[model samples]
Each structure stands twice: as structure tokens, then as C-alpha cells.
Target: MNFDAFITCAVTGSGQSHKKSDKVPVTPKQIAEACIEAAKEGAAIAHIHVRDPETGAPARDVALYKEVVDRVRSSDTDVILNLTAGMGGDLILGNVESPLPLGNGTDMAGATERVAHVEELLPEICTLDCGTMNFAEADYVMTNTPGMLRAMAARIRDCGVKPEVEVFDTGHLWLCKELVDEGLILNDPVLVQLCMGIPYGAPNDPNSLMAMVNNIPKDWVFSMFTIGRMQLPYVAQAVLTGGNVRVGLEDNIWLEKGVKASNGDLVARANTILSAMNVNILTPAEVRAKLNLKKRG
Candidate 1:
């Protein structure tokens, strides 16, 4: 396992969990504040997902992203900003009775439409979900085909931003390799984020985690995270596998069973674990240099 590690706190994700916990930030101001708090708690990076203020639903408005970026940039914190380009692909399938068209709640778009926010508010790191899958109990499908992923990657390259290829399964990793092979992704130290223990993706077992780690290219920079109870376990697992770690309310809402956690609590917990293991948690500048990410302009 590598000694140098960095913790990334995903402040608030674009999911249907706003009502589940009041800690999840819904407005742009609230989200930026959450990032700041996480940074204060020793997180080197902050992964962000914007939502509508009133309804607390996921939104793709460029202005919303602009506000978020502006607030974080103007803040005292120096956390590396990572915006989500994983929106705009929510496809809810209808029941068997009416499966031809999309369901009534489907909110999806094409590749270019998915990344409209990233184009405008070009953060240092933006996520490109490598593949699609069923998201929890939702009737929707998170769609990201090879063609769409390639297009999104090209756009991210054009924006002079690094794309953290988010791999939810082995097949998604294969797609990431395909992107590299096709030259859509610039050949450098690739950044891959292994999303474990999702509803339909890879499980959070030791074998599954190691299988994914073993398959990753040696030169690739990777991070790992799991949801709910497995969040902290994956932190140690990720560190043990010579990779960085990601933790926040986006994946796990609770610090303990039935105890909802804030972003700061999650970062602090990860920091404690890393420190106890004699691993130095990286700072924001260290992470930026390690990932070769340009500071947000």
C-alpha cells in the first residue's frame, strides 16, 4: 500500500435523498458551505453535485453551477473542486404496461447536454461516469454509452480539465480503457474512481475490491468508496491497496448506524483512520500536484 493518501469529500450528491436527511445541501450556497466545512476538516478535494433550491431535485442549470464555483473559489478554503458531469442521463423506464416511451419522471439528455454545466464552469476535476446502471430503487437508469462517454471525455479535454473516470463495475473500467485506446482521453496518469457497493454494481467484499484494484493499470491514479456501513471499511481497503480514498455523505449518510453524518464528520473520521495507520493524509495542494490537476482559473 502507498503511504501518501488524500481524502475527497463528496459534499452532496444529485440523488433523491434531500428529504431523507436535512444535512444534504440542496441550494448552491448550502452546497458550497458544505464543501468549505469538509475542507476545514482535512479533506483535500470536494466533489460537488448541484440541486434545485426549492424542490431539492437534481438540476442541470449552468447558472446554478456558476454560483457554486464562484462561492467555493471565493471562499477561504483551498479544496480542489470536482464538479459532476454525471447528470443529464437519468432515464426512467416505464412499467411493462407502457414500456415503449420513457416513464413520466425521466430526466435525461444526450452527451453534450449532460456536460453543459462543466463546459461553462470548468472545474479542475470533473467526473465522467464510464457506464450506466440502475440507481437504487429508482425506476430510472443512469445512461452512459461508449459513444457518449467518448464525447464527454473529448469535451472535458477541450475545457482543459481532468476527467476522473468513475467506474462502477469491471465493464466500466473496460470502457475507460477503450477511451484511452481511442485517444479520447489524453494518455497520462489516468484517474479512475472505483465506486463500490452500489445497488447493482460491484460488491464491497475484499475479493471484489481487490479484483478491481488488480485490474487497474499500475500507472493509473485511483480512489475507492462504498456506501452506508461500508464507507469506512472501504477507506482502509482503499489505503491498503495503494490508492486514495473518497468519503462523504454522498455515499454514506450516517457516521454510525442510525446516526446521520455531516460532510465534516466523514472527513474527520477518514483522517483519523489514516493517521492511526501511519499514513499521511494529503493536503489540497498535494492532491492537485499528485493528480496533475490545474488550479481552477
Candidate 2:
């Protein structure tokens, strides 16, 4: 088992989570506060996603991101920031009969437009989803074409911000390897997030997670996260399989049954779980050094 692990807390996600739990941070102030809280609870990094403050829906607005960044950077708490570049790829299709007219939730955009915040804010790290996949049980899809991946990966590499390539399946891992081979993902200990349990993608089963973990490059520094109920379990599984862990409202919102959790609560629980397993959870500075990450000014 890998005794040293670092936790990444995905502060808020681009999902319909706001509808389910009121604890999901929405406004920039709330998001930044959540990041700080998670860091105080022992998370080394904060994986972030901006949302419409008014409607509590996922958004790709650079201004919103800037506000969140400024707040976090200006704070006393220390945590590596990891903004999500996974937006602008939501494809909501129409009814089975009328597929031509895309649904209203579709927010597709070009590669450059997608990473606008990353280029401007220059967070310590940003995510580059490695492949396209059906998002959930609905008609929604998280579309990340190979060509798009190449472009985004190149941009993030040029920005000098570590690209946390998110791999939801085995094919995504293959594409991540290709990016590393092409020199787009420049970090030596190449970083990846095994985003398991998102429907129509990889399941949150031990066998499937091990398959993905085994395929990861022997040298790559990877983390694993699963959605809903499987989120907490992956913390143990990831550590045992020599991987880092991620938690927060983005993936799961409960500390225990009938108990809604905040970003801090989730990270603390993961911390507790790792500690019990005799795993030394690395701090943000340690994570930076391990991943060769340079924090933005």
C-alpha cells in the first residue's frame, strides 16, 4: 500500500447538485471560502468549478473564476488551486426522435474558449479531460474529442500549469499516454485523476478501478475519485493501489447516511480514513514538490 497520499477537494462541480443539497457553494465568495475550509481540513489541492450564483448551475465565466481566485489567493489558508477546464463540453441532446436540434443545456465551445480562465488566472493546476463520455444516465454527455484534448493539453503545458488529466475510462488513459508521448503533458511525474463511477463510463468497482490503476504509467502520479456513494470508499482503494485520493461536494456530499457534508467535512473524512490505514497524507507543499507543480503568483 502507498503510505503517502495527497487529497484533492473538488470544491464545487458542474452538476445538478445544487438541486439536491443546499451546502454546495455557488457564489465566488462561497466557493473560495469552501476551498480554504477544505485546505484547513487537510486537502492538499482544491479542484474547483464555478457555477451560476443566481441559479446554482455550472458556468464557464472567467470573471466568476477570477473572483474566486482572488479571494483564495488573498486568504491566509494555503492550498493548491486546480480549476476545471471540463466545462464548455456539455452536450445535452434532444429527444430520441429529434436529435438534430440539440438540447438547451449544450454549452459546447472551442478548445481555446474552454481554457480561458486557466490562461488568465494561471492556477497551480488545471484539469484536461482526456476523452469524451456519456455524463450520466440522462441524455447529457461530457464531450472531449481527441483533437480537443491535444489542443487543450498543449495550451495547459505552455501555460506552465500542471495538467491534471482526468481519465474516466481505460480509453481515456490511452489518450493521456498519447498526450504524454507527444510532450503536451510536460510534468515529469505526469498527473492524472481517475474519474471513476460517472455513468456510461468506468464503474466504481474494485476490479474496474484496479484495471485503470494498473494501466497508468508506472511513473505517473495519479489520484482516484468516484461519484455518490463510492466516493469515500475510493479513498481507501486508491491508497491501497498506490494512488492519491479526491473528495468533496462535487463527487459526494454526505459524511454519513442522512448527514450532508461540506467540502471541509469530506476532506476531513478522507483524512481520517487515510490516517487509519497508516497512510501519511501529504500537505499542499509536499504535493507540489511531488508533482513538480509551481504555484502561480
Candidate 3:
């Protein structure tokens, strides 16, 4: 618990948070600027997700990803870039009348299309959702079957990029282990992210958190976070559980009650807490070294 800690600020998620809080970066330029600000505020890593410049919705276009990567790389900030490879497969169910094909606004694609940006941009880290689950209140579903995960893992391995396995529940942990066992993913200190309190997935509770943590392989390097109001409390919980912390507009939009948060404000608040607890907040370079991640080419 007294070990050095690192915080990854998920600057802008590929979600509708932009409308909820203006602080959520929309375009590539805005995202890059937020990353720089987060780095200055003490975030070791910037977890990035590109949005359609016009609509502020999630976009899997390679050009958008390239621009964001270019902007962040060109900036003076020294934050580790962690791109998202977890898009392009959103299946929203429709009524029986139009159930034959997916309803409008449903974006589904092959595994190759999902990782196109990862292969092209070659970031040091990328996220791979280990499993799928029911989404929000709508009839939407996040579908990532075992076969698809294997294919994506093989491609990520070939690219020599570290895959940050994101586990939304216990089943996902089992899937991550399967990937590791199949040799698609390398062994020892597997990178796992315990994503708590994300609609229809695991609830944000001590029992749920402990269950997921207990299931993690002892040799794996792990981090955990919750959404919305639970963000700050989950930080303390994750640290107490001996895992890293993740925070940003992606998971939450407010810094506190009635106060919306900027990406920089969230990171700054987490850093202040870390310092107060006497934990040495590691830098981006330190995180890369610890995780055995190579710099992007």
C-alpha cells in the first residue's frame, strides 16, 4: 500500500460526456490540449478516445486518430498515450419489425477495422475490452465474443503493442486469462483494468471490487476506477487494494457536488490526494518502465 503509485487520466472518453460537461474535449486539438493540461496536473498516462470532430460522438476513423496522435506527440507534454481499440462494435437492438438487421446508429465491424488506428498510429498502449455486456437503459449491447478477442489479441501481439485488458466484470478476467493461456498475450504481470460501476456491469461496491480483485492473477499489474460520483472514493479504494487509479471526464463529469470538472482538475485533485497520503506519484517515464511498455515509433 505504501508503494509508489501512478494515475492515468482518461481525458475524454468516446461517450456523450461532452454534452454533460463542456470540459470534455471534442476535437483532436481539444483532446491534445487536455492531455497536455492533464500531464502538467500530474497524470502519468493519458487514456485517449477520439470523437467525431463535428458531432462529438465516438469515431473509429483512422484519420481522426492520426490527428489526435500527431497533436499529442508534437506537444511538449511527456504523457504516455493510451489509445482506445474498443470501438466500432455497438449493436443496438430494435423492435421486431426491424430486428432482421441492426437498427440505425448501430456501428458494428470486423476486428481488423477496430484496430486499424492502433496498427497505424502504433501507440505505446491500447485498450482491448476483454468481454462484452449489456449497455445502458437502451436496448444497446456491447458485443465482444471470445473469437473476436482472440483475433484482436493476436494482432496486438504482432504489432508489439501492450494491450491494456479492460475487465468490466469477473467473466472478463477469465477471458483475459484465456488469452494469456493461448499465448496470444504475453505472460507475467498482465495489464488488467477493473472497470467498476459502468452501467449493466459490476456495481461499485466493496464486495464487487474485492471479488474482481481476488480473481486477478497475482502476477498481473492492475488498476481500477468507477464512474460519476464514485470516482474519488474509488481512487482511495483502489490504492488501498494495491492497484493503480484512473480518473477523468470519461468516467465522471464533476469535480464535486454541483461543480463540473475539467480533465486537468480531476488529475490535479487525484494528485493532491496522492501527495497527502505520502505516495510518490510516478511519472510517465516511470510508468512505461514499470509496465515494460516501449515508446511508440
Candidate 4:
């Protein structure tokens, strides 16, 4: 079991979570404040995704990212920043009868265009989804082809940022190893996030989680998380299985059945869980040292 683990607070995800929980941050100021609050509550890293302040829709505006990053950096709170590079690859196909025209939600872009924010802001870490898969929606698919992943990984490396390889299934883990073998992932100990319980990804069952874990390279670092009601429980499961933990409004909104949760609440709860298990929660600086991460502006 992992005696020491770090919690990554996914402050705001690029989803319609704001509609479900008023506590989910939408505007740049609110998002940054959420990150700081999570840090104060013992989260070592804040995983961020910006949105349209007016509409509460997911957005890829570089200006918005700059505002959020600048606000967090200027704050007294110290937390590692991890931006989402998983935004621009969304794909919603046209109706099944006639699939010639792409759907309105299709937002595919070139590799460089996808990581524009990573190039400019240069966060300490960014996410690289390892493979394409049919996401939750009926017609939607998360498209991250091998070619696109390689290109994006190369660019993120050039920016001196660590790419947190996000693996949704066993195949994605294989692709992650291939990237490591090809020398695209340059970090001394490659970092990975096992995203379990997504609709079409790896199931959250212990066996499935173990399948993903067993395939990981011995030297790599990984964190595990699941969505919805299982989020809190997985905190213990993750540590017991020799992995770190992740929790925040991004993955799960409700703290309990009839209650809503804030980012700080989630981080604090994870901290309590970890502390109870005699697992030490690593600080942001400690996580940097463990992952061999380079902190930049």
C-alpha cells in the first residue's frame, strides 16, 4: 500500500456540473478561488478547466486560462497547477441515419491548437488523454488518436511540462507505455491518472481497477479516482492499492445523498480519510519532488 499519497483537487471540469451544483466554479475568479480553497484544505494539486462565465459552458479561451492561472499564482495559497489539455478533442457525430456531416458539438482541432494554453501558461502539469473512446453521450466520442497524442506529448515536453497521462481503459494504458517507449514522455518517472467508472471506460470494480494497475510500469507514478458516489470510497481503495487519490467537484458534486459540496469540502474529506488510514498526505512541494516535476510561471 502507498503510505504517502497526494490529493489532486479537480476544481472545475469541462462539463455541465455547474447546473447540478452551484458550488462548482465557473468564472475565472471563482475557479481560482476554488483552487486556493482546496489548497488550504490540503490538496497538493488543483486540476483546472475554465468555462464561459455567462453561459457556464465549457470553454477553451486562452485569456480565461490566463486569468485563472494568474489569480491562483498571485494568491498566497501554494498548490500545484494542472490544466486540462483534453478540451479540443470532443466529437459528437451526426445522426446515425446520415453521418456525413459532423455534429454541432464536434470541436476537433490540430494538436498544436489543442495545447495552446499549455504552450503559453506552462503549468507544472497538464493532462494527455491516452486513447479515443465513446464518452458518456450517445453520439459523442472522446477522440484522442495515437498521432494526436504523440504530437501533443511532444509539444507539452517542449514546454517543459509533465503530461499526466490519463488512461481510461487497458488499451489506453498500453498506448501510454508506447509513448514512454518512444521517448515522447520525457519525465523521469512518468505520471498517470487512472480514470475509472466513466460510462464507457474502465469499470470502477476492484478487479477492473486492479487490471489497470497491474499493467502500469513499476517505476511510474499514478493516481486513481472514480466518479459519483464512489469518489469518497475510492480514496481509501486507491491508497490501499498502492496509488494516490483525487477528489473534487469535477468528478463528484454531492458530498452526500441530499447535500451539495464545495471544492474545499472534497479536499478536506479526502485529507480526513487519508489521515485516518495513517497515510501521509504529501504537500505540493513534496509531490513535485516525487514526480520530478518542474514548476514554472
Candidate 5:
């Protein structure tokens, strides 16, 4: 079991969670506030995703990202910034009978275009989703081809930023290994996030979680999280399995059945869980040293 772990608060996701809960940050200012709040609540890192201010829709606009990053960097609180490089790979297909043209939600982009924000902002860490898979949406697929992943990884590495490899299944983990072997992901103790319980990917079951955990390179650093009610429980599950923890509005919006959660609430709860277990929560500086990250403005 991991007695020393760090919590990563995914401040906002590229999803419609804002429609479900008003607490989910939409504008760049709101998103920056959420990250600062989480940092104050003991989250070592803030995994951020900016949304359209007017529509609350997920956006990859560099200007929006600049606002969020700028606000966080200018804040009094200190937290490791982790920007999402998982956008621009959505692939929503048409009806099964006629899959000729892609659906409206398809926002695929070239590797360079996808990593443009990362290259520009140069966050301490960015995510690199390792593989492609069908999502819960009937016609949508979270598309990330091998070539695209390699290109993105190379670019992220070139920026002197750590790539938090996101793995949803065993195959994704396998592909991550391949990336490491190819030296595209050159971090000595590679960082990985084992995303669990998201519809069609790896389930939140213990066996499945262990299956993915067992395959991770022993020296590599990995954190685990699941969506909805399971998010809190996975804090313990992840720690007991010798991994770190992640929690925030991105993956789960509810603090309880009837109550909504802000990013701080989720981070606080995860902090309580870890405290009860007598685990040490690492600080942003400690996490940077552990992951060999390059902090930037």
C-alpha cells in the first residue's frame, strides 16, 4: 500500500457536467478559482480543462486556456498545473447503416494542432491518452490513434513537460509500455493515470483495477480514479493498491445523494480519506520532485 500519495483534482472536464451541476466551472475565471480552491484544500495538482464561457461546452481555444493558466499562476496558492491534452480527438459516427460522413461531434485534429496549447502554455504536466475506445455515448468514440499518441508524446516531451499517460484499459497500458520503450515518454519514473469506471473502458471492479495496476511498471508513478459515487471509495482503493488518488468535478459531480460538489469539496473529502488512513499527502513541490516536472507560468 502507498502510505505517501498525492491527490490530483481534475478541475473541469470536457463533458456536460456543468448542465447537471452549477458548481462545475465554465468560464476561465471560474475554472481558475476552482483550481485554486482545490489547491488550498490539499490537492497537489489541478488537472484543468477549459470550457466555452457562453455555452459551457468543452473548448480547446488557446485564449481560454491562457486565461485559466494565467489566473492560476498569479494566485497566492501553489499547485501543480496539469492541462488536459485529451481534447480534439472525439469521433462521433453516424448511424450504423450509413457511417460515411462523421457525426457532428467529431473534432479530430492533427497531432500538432492538438498539442498546440500545451506547447504554448507549457504547463508542468499534460495528459497523453494512450489508446482509443468507445465511450458510453451510443455513436461516440474517444479516438486516439497510436501515431497520434506518439506525436503528441514527442511534442509534450519536447516542451520539457511531463506527460501523465492516461490508461483506461490493459491494452492502453500495453501501448504505454510501447511508448516508453520507444523513448517517446522519457521520464525516468513515468507518470500514469489509471482511469476507471467510465462506461466501456476498464470497470471499477477490484479485479479489473488490480489487473491494470499489476501491469504498470513497478517504478512508474500511477494514480487511480472512478466516476460518480465510486470516486470517494477509490481513494482508499487506490492507496491500498499502492497507487495515488484523483478526485474532482470532472469525474464526479455529487458530494452526496442530494448534495452537489465543488472541486474543493471533492479534494477535501479525498484529503479526509487519506488522513484517516494515516497516509501522507505530498505537496506540489514534492510531487514535482517525484515526477521530475518543469513548473511554468
Candidate 6:
């Protein structure tokens, strides 16, 4: 088990969770403020995703991303910024029989367009989903093909930002190696986030987490997280598995059943949990040095 771990708060995701809780930040100001709050509450990194302020849906608007980044960068509090480049790859099929025409929520795009924010803003880190999956068991499929991934990884490298490889299943981990082998990933200790318990991805169990962790290259730095209630438990599970932890309203909004939580609340809880277990919760500066990330302009 890793005695020292860093906490990442995924502030808001590309999901329609605002309807369930008003605490989920929608506007850029709110999102930025929440990120700052999480950082102040002991979160080393804030994984960000923007949403349409009016509609409260996922968005790929560069302007929105810029507003959030600017807000955070100009703030007194310091936190590692990680923008999601996993958008604009949605392929919502009409049905199993008639999948060609596509349906609503399908905002697929080319690789360059997908990473527009990273190119323009140059966040310290951005997420590169290792592989695609039938997201949430819905008709929509998150499409990240190998060729597209190669192109995207190359672009992220060019921008002088680190890509946090997101692995949903064991196969995704293999693909991550392939990217590294092909010279796409260049970090000394490659950053990887094990996205467990999402739909048909890797299950949120100790054995499953260990299976994925055991296979990872010894030098790679990995963090593990799960959705809903499993989110908190994974905090301990991840540290015990010799990995880091992730939490926030994005993965799980409930501090408890029928209780809503903000990004700060979740981060504070994870810090409390880690403190109780005698684990050292790392700071942003510590995480930056450990991950070898350069703060961008």
C-alpha cells in the first residue's frame, strides 16, 4: 500500500447530473470557483469538463474552457489543471439494427477539433481516454479509435502538456503500452488513471483493481477511482493497492444517501479518510514534482 497519495477532484463531468443536484457547477465561474475550493481543501488536481450554462449539458466550447482556466490560473490558490479531451467523440446509434444513421447526442469530430482547448489553453494536464466503450450502457458509444488516439496523443505531446491516460478496462491498459511503445507518451513516469466500475469497464473490486495494477509498468504512476458510493471506498482501496485516489461531484455527488455534496466536500472527505488511515495526502506542489508536470502559461 502507498503510504503517501495525492487526491484529485473531478469537479464536473460531461454528464447530466446538474438536474439531480444544484451543487454541480454549470457556469464557467461556478466551475472555476469549485475547482479553487477543491484545491484549497487538499485536492492536488482538479479534473475539469465544461457544460452549457443554459442547458446544463456537455460542451466543447473553447471559450468556456478558456474562462475556467483563466479563472483558476489567476486565483490565489494553486492546483494542477486537467482538462478533459474525451469530448466530441460521442457516437449515439439509433438502434442495434440501424446504427449507421446515428441519433441524438452524437457529436463526433476529428482528432484536432477534439483537443482544441488543449492546443489553445495548454493546461498542465489533459485526459486521453485509452479506449472507447459503450458509455453507461446507453445507445451512445464513446468512440476513441486507435488511429484517432495516435493522432490526438501526438497533438497533446506537441502542446507541451501531459496526457493522463484513462484506462477503463484491461485492454485499454495494453493500448496505453502500445502508445508508449510507439513514442506517443513521453513522461518519465507515465500518468495513468484507472477508471473502474464504469458500465462494462473494469469492475470496482480489490481483485479487479489489483489485476489492472499488477499489469501496469512498474514505472508508471497510476490513480484509481469508481463511480457512486464506491467512490469513497476506492479512496482507501486505491492507497492500499499502492495507487492514488480520485473523488468529487463528478464521480459521486452523494456524501451519503439523500445528501448532496460539492467538490470541496468530497475532497475534504477523502483527505479525512486518508488522514485516518495514516496516509499522507499530497499537495499540488508535491504532486507536480512527483508527476514532473510543468505549469503552463
Residue 268 shift from truth in candidate 4, angstroms: 0.5
The TM-score, computed over Cα atoms with residue i paired to residue i, of candidate 6 is: 0.98
Backbone clash numbers for all candidates listed? 0, 0, 0, 0, 0, 0
> After superposition on all CA atoms, what RMSD does each candidate show versus the true structure?
1.2, 1.0, 1.2, 0.8, 0.7, 0.9
User: 1 in model 6: Cα distance from truth in Å?
Assistant: 1.2
lDDT of 1 by residue, 1-297 (tens): 868999999988977677889998899999999999999999998999989899998888888888988999998789898999988787777775776577876776887887888888878899999998876754668888777888889989888889999999999998889899887887567899999999899988889989899999898999999988889888888889999999998888889888899999999999999999999989999888888888885
Stretches of candidate 4 above 4 Å error?
Answer: none
- For residues 113-163, what per-residue lDDT tens digits would candidate 6 score against the true structure? 999999999999999998989766558888999999999999999888999
Off by over 4 Å in 5: none
Give the C-alpha lDDT of model 3: 0.88
Error of 6 at 160 (Å): 1.0
Residue 172 local lDDT, model 4: 95
Model 2: how far residue 48 lies from native, Å: 0.4
**What lDDT would each prediction earn against the true structure?**
0.88, 0.90, 0.88, 0.93, 0.93, 0.92
List ranges where model 3 is wrong by over 4 Å: 96-98
Model 4 agreement with the true structure over 204-263: per-residue lDDT tens digits: 999999999999888989998999999999999999999999999999998989999999
- Preferred candidate (TM-score higher): 1 or 6: 6
Per-prediction TM-score: 0.97, 0.98, 0.97, 0.99, 0.99, 0.98
For model 5, how does the per-residue alpha-carbon lDDT over 149-258 read when each residue is reduced to its tens digit?
99999999888889999999889999999999999999578999999998899999999999999898789999999999999999999999999999999999999899
